[model samples]
Target chain A: MSSTDMLQVISKNGKAKRGAEPNLPKKTLLAMYEAMMQTRLLDERMINLQRQGRIGFYVPSTGEEAAQVGSCMALDDTDWLFPSYRVPGLFLMRGVDIQHLVANCFGNEADLCKGRQMPVHYAFAEHKLVSISSPIGTHIIHATGLAMAQKLKKDKGISAVYFGDGGTSSNDFHSGLNFAGVAKAPVLFICTNNQWAISVPIEKQTASETIAIKGEAYGMPGVRVDGNDVLAVYDACKKAADRARKGDGPTLIELMTYRRGPHSSSDDPTRYRGNQADEWLDRDPILRFRKYLEVADMWSEKQETELIERLKAGINAEVKKGEAAGQPSLETMFTDVYANVPPHLREQYENLVRDEGTGHEPDPDAAFPL
Target chain B: MSSITMVQAVNDALREEMRGDDDVVVLGEDVGINGGVFRCTADLIDEFGEERVIDTPLSESGIIGAAVGMALYGLKPVPEIQFSDFIWPAFDQITSEMAKMRYRSGGQFTCPMVVRTPYGGGIRGGHYHSQSPEAYFTHTPGLVVVIPSDPYDAKGLLKAAIRCEDPVIFLEPKRIYRAPKMDVPDDDDYVVEIGKAAVRREGTDFTITAYGAMVAVALEACEKAAEQGWSGEVVDLRTLLPLDEDAIIQSVTKTGRLVTLQEATKFCGFSSEISAIVAEKAIDVLEAPVKRVSGFDVPFPYTLEHVYMPHADRVLKAIEGVMTY
Candidate 1:
């Protein structure tokens, strides 16, 4: 494939183009569409929840569901996933307990993070999904390492990490991709080039022809896909996953997608991006995939309605369950620092309790002398 | 027990751990074939083979970030930073990613890895090679900072760090890696518990607290003080974080005067933290103000490397100043 050529398995009209069909099972394709819809509704609910002050923060996967869900569907349950702030679709596709994901947004006592991290920093150990840290491109190297460890153990598992176009500018991106290439680690680095990192456009992020082409510099195969086309994204990921399992080394897949909503609930896209985003609205992966499924005679209007109602009810119930979990206790702040709390920390905790009784702020200068 | 240097002790500890557990792997620049620049990982590649002993590209961030990933995947990766000064590139991986993995995952995932690096100044490595960056690691919660002064402690603590369930920053004192050989146990099961300070010498005149290379320097300073008819107690803090406050408080209570020594710069250094803790718990028992003998508050210089580090004279001066006060 040429460097600038985009690999697409589906066209804008929701029809399989020549040499593009992923040939996934009809059941699997239907499930992928359901996950995309579920993710869309979850993003909408989360954005609404944040606006209503029910949740603290949110980063909606809005227009990029196909890129997130389709690629995730291509991987097996054993393959590890290291997702970025976006891509809740990937988590949903992996069967991550929605309750846990929602509870994390609430940062409640039941939350896996123990209220230590921001919302969307979801981590489910059983799912083989590593915890999400706020730093962009950091997980790329971590995924590479996980792949290396798997390779050392002679395991057939591969690691898939997802990041945004903004992550490409991070030094860790270079470090991770270079190391992965040199080590021939079984890792798939998927960059959802959503065209913006906060307000910074892709044009200003790098002057390179394409993010996928940069993989060549790091000694890895690079491929660009029509990220909005779920089939295309799924095909690219499946191929990369196969290559990784066969010890063909890492591959960088730049999913050509777009962010339909503001960067996060905290951001205002109108300030940076004009009405240009309206053009991407028609390219909605959910709508496009729904049309494709209808042409395949595997979907109906009733099915779409049922899925929407089911997801709305499920997400709403989960939000209520999440909100009801309540805030973590004050003592939780001191816990999880270490497996065993050391003597000094225990004493410090007692001191805090003692100081709390007096209802006064700690005066370290008064407590200790020069 | 076998006589060995800190470097040899470290190599033995890594070999022992790698042999004891199949999950234990060592990775870093020049760690495989070259056996590391300081020879701390010498012969490890041949013994453990290339799979377990990985020679990574010269990228500090990559080394640490990948180690965190490896640790998450249930491997005990002991990654080396070559020198403590080079750890800056991996600071984000250590502080933001590795350290927070366990806490952020609510104990579901843990980075049971050891980051080994040579630290401190004495053999004229200048600024780039010589540095005591323990305070930075100590400042980060969810991280265990260990610095061993001698071969015995180096071997024992290293073995313990490798088995630790959380991330550990093992700062090997480069200056004393070869000097002052000591008896280290050859047993594979030998391990010194972290977060416990060792009292090297017992005295009542004053207490001297130090770690890593400063432990030997403090002992030498105590010897010089003894010639002046003063007896001083010495404490070697094997671990910086989860600091053995009980040991520190106990020593200060007995001596009624404290002198904390460190090779890091004076500003916000480990010595200051120790001094603060001493003042917090044992102020009533103190006869004189706690003194801190530490490096100057400036970047380590090439020409004045010795002067920039806390030597016996500086430590003795603090001891004498505390006594006179």
Candidate 2:
């Protein structure tokens, strides 16, 4: 497919375009829908928790569920996922326990990051999901490196990296794609072109006609897909993964979607943007997928209600458990910095432990007066 | 044991490590085929093949950034930055990502990689080629900053760094990469433990604290001081992050006079940290205040590099100043 042409499986009215749908198993299709629903519920609850001062901060991927979950479904379980902050759906699709995700949000003892990282920066090594960092496009080169290693070891699995349109302009984007193209690394560069990066529009982010087309400059094929349609995302990603596995080098797949909410709980879209575009609102990924599911007799109003209630209750219970678990151990601060603590750090830890609870504690309510 | 240059020692270390572990890979610009600009990776491509000794693009950030990923994937990647002066481009990856990977991931993910770069002035490489940026890495926690003075320590320290569970910044003193040959063990098992300081010269009148190329200069200054009826102790601090505070304190307490030397700029250099450690720990035993002889607080000069580097003369002056004080 041409870079300018966007692949679409499901039409605006929820009807599948003739012969365009992927041949996914019935169980996999239902699992995709469930994961999308779970992601939406979790995002809404987390944002509400942030608003209620129960959590410090959260980044919601409300509108791009299809892009995140569908692309994730296309990968092998052994394939490494280097994701940005806005791909919580990808985490859920990969079977990350909701309670552990909530623990990360609460920065609790059970959190995989042991409260060291900021909220929503999740990492699960067992699932081959690399830890998320705040810096943009850095993981892109890492994915290329891992993919190169895979190629050297003749591993069947490839690596996939997820970033946004704004990330396309970052230096690492150029470095990663160029290196991957040269090495013919078995990797997929998935750019979720959500139009806005914080406050900067895509128009200002780059002068290129399309982010995907920029892949040609690095000797890679570029494809664009209707990110609102899960089938299209899955199809494009699956094709890209196949090519990468065949040693055809990396492919840049741009998932054309929109950020339907504020960048994060701390951001206010109303200040920088006039309003949510009606065109994008109509093309909401979850609603479009739900419509497609309903049209296929795979879902119904009764099932939707039950699913929403079940997800809400499950998420709320996880949030309650995370909150009750409290913060990580104070000793954890000195641990994990090194495999074995140095003498100086050991002394510092001893001093802190000796003076524990002696310092004045700040009021939690007054800490974040937002 | 074989007497060899620092660069040869580094090559031996890499060859030995690669031969021992299939996961130990070396990647950098011109590291393969061309055998690296300094020949530090000479004949490695032929031995380990292009896959292990990779010649990467000229992007320093990509070299380090990709190495971080390789390390995350259970490969001990030793990525060369070519020169420490060019390391700023990959500073974000080195500091924010590589160093903090294990800690930020709560030990779920770790970057057990070594970033090897040639550092320090006296190569006449001017501004872009010569620099002593060990202070920057030393300031960063979670990074084991090691700088070896001679060939013996280069191979041993690099092996220790490669075996380290954490990320290590192995800064090679390019000024002495070819000079100061030492009998380094041919065995792969030889490793100089990290965070321990080696006392090169024992004395009682004063103490000279230094590392990397400065260690040689400190030793020379110690010899000159000995000729002038002053016994000066020289401590080679192989690792800077988990600093050899015990060695520094012991030497300072014994001599009661301290002089710190480094090729880095005088302001906020690793020498300042050494002086601070001595002040904090061995102040009561100190007869004179700690004196630091370091590069001037200016951009590393090209034509004036000799004036920029701390030689034995300047170190001797500092030693005499601290002795008289």
Candidate 3:
């Protein structure tokens, strides 16, 4: 197959070069760029939030803007998105309000998760985004199952699932891929092989040269790309999403990206990683795209200044809006425990009401034991 | 109004439910072509076709574990374990993973799967085939445990289980699979509510609560007690977990004494929970302490089969002891 068939555009610089690109207008591209910049600023600010002990840990999709925003931008609004911990870029590009992210990170009252879940375990059922669990590979299986259901429902849109190199080690990963392949389910598994899983290197995660190669065993096409390059990620994801809609089954795309920050806002990356960090920084997708736009005279230093000011102001407003929502009601605890809470739990909640106002925190250490 | 054996009732229930819902699928070891070791799933493959009736390999974890995954996707999976004693291999997948997924996802997810297995001792099947394992699941929170004693309840409760939106462990007393039969509701739209007990006999002297095969023994003991001039109210606890505490309290209220029986090890059995609840809820109504008449705390006996199962005589003795106290 010709290489151009797999990609719509290729450039080290983010310019309006007219070399076989999509019909996407210049205005749409600029909007996408603004979204990516917003996500980066948000990531940096959230890390500061963590440092100030305002929010808990966060996993930034920082150096991989092209991969995150590009693939997400390619899909329709109705298409299902199953994201791993990172990918705030995709979340922002998909139009999840910045205030919601702030409420989520701060785990406040306005948070859709009811403050019960950890930060980053985002769930917006209306957006077709299934809730994320702390367990790594469980959602891979769930995504496959959801895709199969969509097949039964004859849904026009395809399911897009995100995972990491470390997630591929789970047994469900193999089972999920195998089932989707055999059933010819419309789904795309985008593996953001960011090279590190909390200190475990990609070399240790798999002996295969690329994360996409594992797809061969499941009888699906596996493709490797420059994850930092937004154009490549967009083009590859677009092709796969089209094939999926055509009932061609699933494809695994390995986007070789990097984690510029700590695994979360926690940890010190300088302790273990090598000069590879400096190398990844050089290939930084956002900067490379900015350079390409500069070469085309499509972007300027003034645009960067305006973009930062707009994003910072927008984010600060959202942060204030999120904080003003106040903490989720202590009463939010009783809700979402079940579709219909049993009498036992209701009695416990009533006891709490009778005692003070809301139920005291149940003994989590005794119940969860983990 | 026809009489059927326990296994036949299960077969009838599966056939009826399949005819009712296209999404219900039956998959397990030897459950399709081979008709299951106990013949509980006989003729399902021909009736429902391969897509609905699956004969899986001997992988307990894979069978129950994958059913959990399948059920989460909207298909109703009824997975059968060959024997109650062998369910532990899939217990972690069932109890920890499947049972808790809905709650852990904080109600965002639900797995509606049922694991049907033949349980309890009576025939000379020894420890592996015998053994009552419902106690382990009764302790689990999200799972609904159902053990049917006769054909009537089996057909009704199982249909309820297959449709219910929770992981249910449906234990069919293997020894009584062909032992007895009774009239059941017709037209196949029967659904006995889960977590409710059926009263076999109503009497005011003492209460006898049991389930699975032991309910028959308890009834027989109550019959034998009529000669000795003692009254007994027998409650067949159809659902063990989310147990019918209401029926138990009501029965104990009149009898003023309770004797719980099971074909399981006496230690940490379902009877233990019944005793605790009776003490907690019905302390005022009790004229005597609630006693549990269970099998010895040993691996089910292989050589001494009759001694292994709870007998009518033991039930009678326990009833007499509780009433006199």
Question: Which candidate comes out best when scored by lDDT?
Answer: 2
DockQ of each: 0.79, 0.87, 0.29
* Fnat score for model 1: 0.79
Between candidates 1 and 3, which one is better according to lDDT?
1
Model 2 lDDT tens row, A93-143: 998888889999888779989988778899999899999999989999999
Chain B TM-scores per candidate, in order, are 0.98, 0.99, 0.97
Give one digit per residue, the lDDT tens place, for model 1 in B49-159.
Answer: 988999998999999999988988889999999988988889899999988887888888888899999998987888898888888889998999999989999999999
In model 1 chain A, which range of ten residues has the least summed lDDT?
A361-370
Which clashing pairs does model 3 show?
A13-A292, A14-A292, A14-A293, A15-A292, A15-A293, A109-A327, A109-A328
- Candidate 3: residue A259 lDDT (0-100): 77
State the iRMSD of every prediction, in order shown.
1.0, 0.7, 3.6
After TM-score superposition, what is the CA distance of residue B317 in candidate 1 from its true location, in Å?
1.9
Name the runs in model 3 displaced over 4 angstroms: A1-23, A265-278, A359-370, B14-142, B165-175, B221-230, B263-269, B293-325
Please provide TM-scores, in order, for all candidate models, with all chains considered together: 0.97, 0.98, 0.84
Candidate 1, residue A7: the lDDT equals 85
lDDT, residue A56, candidate 1: 71
State the C-alpha RMSD over the true interface residues for candidate 3, after superposing those residues. Answer: 3.6
Between candidates 1 and 3, name the one with more favorable DockQ: 1
